[model samples]
Target: MAATDRAEYCGIGIRGVAIGIDSFVWFALLFVAITVTGVVTGQVETGAQGVHTSLSGTPGSIALGLWVVLTLGYHALCEWRFGKTIGKALVNIRVASTDGSAPSLGAALIRNVARLVDWLPSLYLVGIAGMVLSDRRQRLGDRLAGTTVVSD
Candidate 1:
């Protein structure tokens, strides 16, 4: 809402669409990786309920660890390097510092890490609350990183 700014802050609705796209991609990637690892490591099971994996032992731990790394790294690296992930790019939005510069690597990392906290209590309620309360429509991650998703 600055006089000189052409880029407007995005709200939760469009942001939600971008996240849906990103989450679908993330889910697909995780499904493949976990399924392959589980089968290869003999950690998968076919039950009356459904086909699933026991992510409970060392193999499970490693798979979970990989998920953590991939999820965080994917968002942070993309935001740092290009200001947008594929979903955000498709939505024509980008993350930028409050001062209108590209976000730094540290900022991007903090933003993605804060996503864990924002995801708490299910369905990104915390993030939505933060965005609603913020004057610039920032989620917790954006506020923490001094970044905002903006129209491109």
Candidate 2:
């Protein structure tokens, strides 16, 4: 491949860094939401030892559902509308169709949804392996969605 062709594909290290940044964002959101919910619902209780937090029943269920939507929706909306997440944008990478065009919503959804499989055997072992072995450096989700993570 020519230099430009090679430049179009992002490798594992940068992708991993992008994901790490994304995870921090997710964690921060989760922490804020949980803290706010605990405060509003009085889910945090003072224990003999120290401060404690607990949630169950309706509140717990609602939190769980909302988290799922927010987590998935964050990726889907970002990819479909901008072709990249905040992390990917910061890292100067993007998710694009194999044909080098922006991915459609359906394609982006497929890519994000396939994360379930990509995470198999813990910590994306399979997905990492696939990226390392594939010519395009794609994960399972990228392959399934007919997309690639590229430098921008």
Candidate 3:
């Protein structure tokens, strides 16, 4: 294979850093969204009932739903449109198909969806193990989606 055709996978340390950056970004977004929502709705009740009301089904469910959308949308759109999230860009990495091209929306969606599996038992232990074990340094999501994260 030509040097150009030989894929160079990104290492775990850098990938971890990229993920850290994305996590920080996600946290900021969630904080802002929740704050704005609370201010606009004035949903906070007073006294002991306040906590209960805030944690009750509707508001809590709405928050959860919004979080899921924001998180998944962020990953899916970024991967599809740019092959990289802001964090991935900052880290000089990108996601691409096995043949080394921009991934399709289906591939992006599959990877992001499979992220749930990679996240099993918390802190992405399964993903970490997969990346460590895989020849292309793929996490479970990447493997399932037939994609890999590589240095750009």
Candidate 4:
């Protein structure tokens, strides 16, 4: 790819904003599912009693597990199928290896798996700092996976 195809920054700021938006949406969906389940179960309670209640019901566990599945599984599937997330699509950006090709499954998994570390210590400061400091705008995960986020 031509140098002009790249930007001085990898657009992590924009990606962060997109992630915030997605998180809000996911939270809303999860809340709705939880609410619906509670209503159907007729298990609604009031005040601090509700707070003390445990979500140990099988249905509740399944719903919670599905939420987790949706979050991680969706990202993996989207990266494999479209080379980006919905946010990346909106910004016309994609994640690829430094070689300017789609990242391999191993690379993608490695980068995503390292997200736990990138998100360490609070608010993804480490990841954000790495993106800002690196000449290629790569976060720690990107560096580890030999990947880069680029605009199409």
Candidate 5:
């Protein structure tokens, strides 16, 4: 195989913005889905007093399942197929294999699944720490998946 040139990794600043955008997209989707599901199932009650959401029983289970699938699938599928999520596209960055190819499905899954770990203790504090500490500007997911976030 031919040797690939090193990638110019994106800084935490831009990456942060990209993730912020992506977070909004996926979380919004999840929120809407769960909200509609709750209302449709009579699990979400709104009155003059306040709004109450009951995420228990079948409806709760469905919401939980949707949360897991949508969160994981959004990142994994987008990176695997398009090399970037909506947020990354907006910021003009992309995730690519260190070998200078598009990230494979396996790689995207590994990275996005690892996102659970990266999200520990707060809003991506661990991921930010990883990016700060690593010379390659990678979070845990990127390192495990052998991928990098680079200029598009």
Candidate 6:
């Protein structure tokens, strides 16, 4: 492909690293949020208490769900406003359609929702693997949506 095409495409290799970095940052943020919530709530339990706590539907699950929503919202808003997430902005990368245009709202939402498949199980290993192996560095979502992440 031409340099311009490459610039407008993620090409598996580069996008893999970017996705890895993004996942690490997101997980770190989630961890911090959970820790802070625990501290604030004074609900830190020990041994069997911890097991029981989880069995009883821990507040952490609610917080985690909220975090997921907020994170997706941030990504959607940032991509709409600036074509990148903070991490993507820092790395000079942007998410766009294959035609070198910003993705539409429907496309963005579809891509992110498909992230469930990309993030299967945990740690985003599936997404990372797919990105590394795919021609366009796309996870399942990007493939399905005809979108791409590119260097801006």
The ten-residue window of minimal lDDT in model 4 covers: 2-11
What is the lDDT for 137 in model 1?
A: 87
Q: What TM-score would you give candidate 1 relative to the actual structure?
A: 0.83
lDDT for model 3, please.
Answer: 0.82
Model 5 C-alpha lDDT versus the unseen true structure: 0.86
Q: What is the TM-score of each candidate against the true structure?
A: 0.83, 0.79, 0.83, 0.69, 0.81, 0.67
Worst 10 residues of 6 by lDDT: 48-57
Question: Which regions in candidate 6 have their CA more than 4 angstroms from the true location?
Answer: 1-8, 11-13, 16-58
In order, candidate lDDTs are: 0.88, 0.82, 0.82, 0.71, 0.86, 0.70
Clashing residue pairs in candidate 6, if any? 12-137
Better of 4 and 6 by lDDT: 4
**1 or 3: which has the higher lDDT?**
1
Count: clashes, candidate 3: 0
* lDDT-superior candidate, 3 or 6: 3
Per-residue lDDT of model 6, residues 1-152, tens digit only:
43337585566556556566677767866766565556656665668545222212567776687568756766666676677876787777888887777888777877887787787878777777778887777878887777778878
lDDT of 3 by residue, 46-137 (tens): 67544322444665666666776788788988999999999999999999898888989999999998887888989988899999999889
Model 4: CA > 4 A from native: 1-9, 28-69
> Tens digit of lDDT per residue, candidate 2, span 1-152?
43335556887799989988899878866766666667778888787897666778887776666666676778878999999999999999998888777889998898888877888999888888889988888899889988889898
Give residue 76's lDDT in candidate 1 (0 to 100).
96
| Weakest ten-residue segment in model 2 by summed lDDT | 1-10
lDDT of 6 at 65: 75
Q: Which stretches of candidate 1 lie over 4 Å from their true place?
A: 1-4, 35-55
Q: After superposition, how far is residue 88 of candidate 1 from its true place, in Å?
A: 0.6
